[model samples]
Target: MMVEIAIFFLLIFMIIGMLFVLEIENLLSAVVMMGAIGFGLSVIFLLLGAPDLAIVQIAVEVISVVILIRATIHRDIKERADESLSNISSIPLLVCIFFFFLMIYPALRLLPTFGEPVFLNFYSSSVYYLRDGFHLTGAPNIVSAIILDFRAYDTLGEAIVLFTSVIGALSILRYRNRKKEHNAS
Candidate 1:
């Protein structure tokens, strides 16, 4: 019950944070709100009994926020002469958001109640992993064994993807800085 309540509040905070991020005119404040939302998600992950996921979520969130802050720190927000156009553009986004929730409402209702086991019956592969993962992979932790040994290639691929994304962000930031300097000169 406590976990459910905590999750509920965290979800609420995350939703509100996202709205703030979207609506706030200040870029830095928006980044900070995004960080708050990310941390809220990490907390929810921890409360749900997935500490590993929580750790990863927090790490990714921290890195992403750092990058975003760096990217926005030196920039100034330009005022638009046509504010009405901006407001008009947002109408479609609002409509899309409403329709998205409408589409997913039924799926959300089908989900099991909070704190209930998602799978009433475990799969054979899951049983095998639990029974033999440590022995086969020689890892003391079953989760470690499964991720690092059994799914080694998948793990490597994910790591590569993360690395690529970070590099891409950094390069883009550097390129933007260079372009700004060139234009200023």
Candidate 2:
């Protein structure tokens, strides 16, 4: 009963937020609308009994929304230039959206039929005894055990390995912005 009430209120808030976001002329209003929507969706997730996903979504939404609002708040609100997004070519955009939905549909549908999962098909399931850490090993945290103790330096070394990749990507992207990049860096 309480869950249904929470869902109803969340739905109402989300609809109001969407309308505000779409109709608002001011950027700050739009940001607030979107943030409200994000927070409302987070609450909806919690009501649906997915607390883990709700926590992750809330954290990500909060950080990104704050960054967006902070950036847009400094911009000139008085500059009300009418722009036509309809003039832009939307064929490619429609095609991308269609392709994404097509891809995601099959993946979502397959989630249920994936059955007893990979471990069941394999020699023995690791998920059941993952907490034990290979029959009473010292590692309490499964992920920590896998990353730090077992794999150890393999994880730490990847950061160092990715340094060159980052530099290469930046170099490629900034080929035309050499002067700007040099000044910023």
Error of 1 at 52 (Å): 1.4
Residue 45 shift from truth in candidate 1, angstroms: 1.0
Per-candidate Cα lDDT values, in order, are: 0.85, 0.75
Worst 10 residues of 2 by lDDT: 78-87
In Å, residue 151's CA in model 1 sits off its true spot by 0.6
Cα lDDT tens digits for candidate 2, 30-71: 887898899889988888866766887899798878878877
Task: Please give, for residues 1-185, the per-residue lDDT of candidate 1 as tens digits.
Answer: 89888899999999999987766777888888999999999999999888889999999899889988988988977333453344467689899999999999999999987666755356666678788887798887777888898889999999999899889967976987898999999
Tell me the lDDT of model 1 at 24.
73
Write down the RMSD of candidate 2 (Cα, Å): 7.5
